[model samples]
Target: MNQRPKLRSPPPSSAASSPSPPTSPNLNRDKAKTIIKMPRKSYIKPTLVLASLLTIFALYTFLFYTPPNYNNNSSNLLNLVNKFDTNNSNVNKVKIYMYDLPRRFTYGVIESYAAARGGGQVEKDALLKYPGNQHSAEWYLFSDLNRPSESRINSAVTRVMDPEDADLLYVPFFSSLSLVVNPIRSANANGPADRPTYNDEQMQEALMEWLEEQVYWKRNNGWDHVFICQDPNALYKVIDRVKNGVLLVSDFGRLGRNQASLVKDVILPYSHRINTYNGDIGVENRKSLLFFMGNRYRKEGGKIRDLLFQVLEKEMDVIIKHGTQSRESRRAATQGMHTSKFCLHPAGDTPSACRLFDAIVSLCIPVIVSDYIELPFEDVINYKNIAVFMDTTTAVKPGYLVKSLRRVSTERILELQKELKKVKRYFEYEDPNGTVKEIWRQVSSKLPLIKLMTNRDGLIRLQNSPQSCYKISLYIENLDYQEPATTYFGEKPRPAKLACTIISMS
Candidate 1:
């Protein structure tokens, strides 16, 4: 190792007999006191200069160094409030208050059934293995809305804790989860001995009873309350009672005539089982003409699908496989749809199925064969641009479906596919326009009507209770220091006494 450099020392100072003229001891003492008493101001100036420089740097970073698109990425609460136009400030935000329902209604069902029924952790972990398998609608919605998002613009609503501050009351009950879990089998399927009790109905009954006890429910009788009944059969037993409430569902297939309308109830899209397809599999790479993989033996409206399958099974370039509800089936469906140009979306038990969204995700143009089908986000998206809709009679006619599909210009089909790709984000579970945001937007549209009904109900209540005594409390910040308050009115007011109290804040 190399030796270190040696250090040098300065010469010692010599003592001096008195730099200044000799003074009296008392005079020295007074001089020392005066020097010690002089104010120390040098350190403070540098400290203040440093503080000013730091403040200037901070201001520069905030006002100039920030990106021009800061608002797009900002999650600040003030930014959320400032996005709305000055004229529409009052109507921009809709405050929703969620009810504290029992676990059995939402997450309890997920924990109990989602893990076990979906194959424990193995199935959930493998969700990424296959590109197109999505969680159930109830799971998607419950998970998405549980957290707040910064990108939600048109539906920039807030969830409030206090019921009194709410524009709409949200019942966070996962109706589908409760129904799918602990499913009851039919007596006819298991021979007459197995009795079928309506579990979904019983749950709804208990839920209604619990809701009726709450003070918020008594206010407008649930007119401002919103319920999520995404599954067709969910809350079917108590449909009439909750009909007046804002009902959010995937479709109106399960509702009878006059049960649900577009004005009162919102149509939500089925959570696509597939992730978005961003591949370059244009019309050229898509060798298969049309594809449909579902149950060939379905009842009611699904019979049309069965007939089409029989007719198209032998057709060249058309893939029609018998469908089953299994992982293998889902994987096969995903692969088949990826290679096809047009995916067939026919009525099953209901006119709408998750298949349409799957096709959209796979960049396959959907050939919708349901005449009475209702699509989600129709107000925002024109379905005709992305899908080919056919009447039942026209589709069922001999060779009509294939002939009509063949008649579609290759360019037209490509256009539909491009449009399908554009709308795929809306149907995706993670997108801002997914279930939560769309549901909020739908609910926001109905707020004006809901407010009108609420005001009318209030007037009716007031009229019915003319003798009701109302007590108002006024808070004064500094009672003793402020001058006496004065009031002016054109008309005489009712005689009332005022009370005051003094309290120290500091």
Candidate 2:
């Protein structure tokens, strides 16, 4: 519009030579395509590389990893599992096969004893009562196994009708009762010539004859068999013959070291004869400081009873009298123990007696004076927690035991009473999860050892080699108990020594 210097267009030839004005729209479109296509190609290569690395790493981990050793840690694991199963009532039980012996071996003994006592007839199936004595564990265990499976859901042993499914073979002979009911005879005495009937020796011989004929007994050489010989003299004639089997015994007094040991045998609690004290644990009702009411004279290891009585009978607040198993005596002994703070548990004919269990059920702290005593359920029970253990040497000293009792603080006494209450149920035979189940549990624990022994009996033959000596050291945790550790001396036939020690976790 500036007045129009009407300039003619430059020549078309000159415009064509200047590269056609740069083409701006087509250049921008080409740059956009390049950006999108380049990013797509770069992403594909990196994605493939990452996936390959992940696959290789997974394969390496799957082929090369190793777990840590668990052999030494098995005890802790087993304890955890046991705690869970105990609280859940899911304990694994032993499958028992009970032999169907004739009535003369089982309830017949009970019936004969009852008839002699002028009692009414005992119904075979309805027989639940046993003589009120310490050697009644056989009766209790037999009765428990005879019950229906549904009735014993929480029992530690189940009766299997078929022997093929059995973990143990139970010979339900009333050996202890038979011994008690029959007349005593010399070791060399034969049967009575007047009557062609059975005596204890004849009954024992008959049992062995019947047992030797059984298929299972011959199959395992009786190594997997179970016999309830709770009395020290229960099966005296047949003891050596049945020594390879599992013997449920009271103590090792009458048995040789080779005949029974903690390795292959189970120590059972004597059936308590006194009434159980159901009251709370406290000292307010207790009046006496020490109580003991048993035979003052005894034999062998039991000689210590006389020595202990000489030192304790004259002490103040003490009741130490000689009593036998009678109605009035049981009542008096029950009263004495229930009111006493501590009950004396000296050695009997054996290292143990029913008095110890009686004291346990009565909630009286046991003053154990037997040096070589082997206790029942020692693996699970810490005797130091519920009882006072004194060496036989010191216990017989004139002023030692009484002075020790006076030194125990009230707090310590209460603690002991509380522990006694907690464990008393284990000594009870009537409770569902009591002595019967506990005995079965202990037997079940011996299954592994039984199998080992059974297998070794067939494999190893020791020709004139001395019996292998076992010095078992039992470490009791969380206590101050200690005994001299005895080393294994394989030269002679020495009884296996159980050495205990305290191991503090703290």
Candidate 3:
């Protein structure tokens, strides 16, 4: 009864307070005016980006980071390899094409006098009377230039047998041997004696005529041809004819005023008796301070020697022997240079002599006293470190030569000797790969000038027989005609740049 009474009396506020069921937002139409949603992303995408960053970091570490022990390992490896390395450096080689000259031109000189004069034997005996051998370079060039070789340290050049394919035309004329084959006229001769009676003149004329008739010679006017004129007087008779050829000369002493120049000619070295000075005598053990032993009376350059001899004769440390080269003198020279620290290399009749090379082999620093002295391999060896260059005017001054030598410090002398030891190979011919390689390297440098001349005159192609043969011409044909050049060469065609033989395809 009380419940019924209460229900009846329940107010509107009590009815609103009664519990209600949950309503959807869409059910409230007036309140649901607008809605907004957020986009979703995958968790795998962010993980992939993190993996890529780590991979890049690993690569950077590998490239830029070096362990502290890396230098130690590198030095150890280099030391191990250096023992076997000859240290010749990278040899710059040029392709050489050798012409098969008639035997009379190249080998005939030695054959003619092999029995009576014994070719180089007489020359070697004569040189043993002095500090160095005179005709050694001629022998070396002739023996090793085009001779077949099985293996050699990066030689500076290669040889080709074909004339049409050569960068330089080498005439194998033994010009120096020809001069020595005949008896030498006395220096004081009056009439016909003044002129050489040697057959070198005849050989030279024959060679020039043969060369002029060759296709290569006519193309360049013999400008690119190589001639070995070691003796200044060896080829003087017909120098005018071959003046334009590449002259390999010992010195310009015999050349007329306007004929010889460094621009057109190469200075060759006198062959030294390498056996005497080949061993390493201690530089510190050298007893004498200054030494000179050679001819005193010379024509052009010996005037300075005479002056030095007179001035230094009385000096305590200076030992001067003014005499001709005799058996006793030659033995004395070997001993003198071996024991001395400084050797006086004043010019003789020429501006250069074999003494300088002997001094180099002896490891005795050279006191070069000449005004216009030209040196062999000047491009490769720096003579300043191993030699003292005092012009004739300065060296002729009394006491100057000794004074300058004395002023040089012991450390400096030892340093110069060390440098001298390094370059001894450059002046030696026993190793076929040594000095000849250097000569070929220098000659190779002149190829640019030769090419320039050839290109300027449009004579780059060989004007031989019937076909145009050159690297450029061959390339044009390969591109345009696709024709093989085997018919012309009669062998597998080499690259046009290296083509050395010409044959007729027709």
Which parts of model 2 have CA positions greater than 4 angstroms off?
1-92, 118-128, 183-198, 460-506
Model 2, 180-276: lDDT tens digits are 6744468997754643233789889999998898889877778899999998998999988898889999888888987889888899998898999
Best by TM-score: 2
Reference-based lDDT, residue 373, model 3 = 75
Best by lDDT: 2
Q: Give the range where candidate 3 is weakest over 10 consecutive residues by summed lDDT.
A: 124-133
**Every model's TM-score:** 0.68, 0.72, 0.68
lDDT of 3 by residue, 310-418 (tens): 7888987888997665668777888899889999999888898888888888898999987787798787788997898888888878877788888888889888988
- Indicate the residue-level lDDT of 226 in model 3: 76
Model 2 scores what on Cα lDDT?
0.82
Write down the worst ten-residue block by lDDT for model 2.
497-506
Better of 2 and 3 by TM-score: 2
What is the total number of backbone clashes in candidate 3? 2
- For candidate 1, the C-alpha RMSD (Å) to the true structure equals 19.7
Model 3 residue runs over 4 Å out of place are 1-93, 118-132, 149-153, 183-198, 256-258, 274-283, 457-506
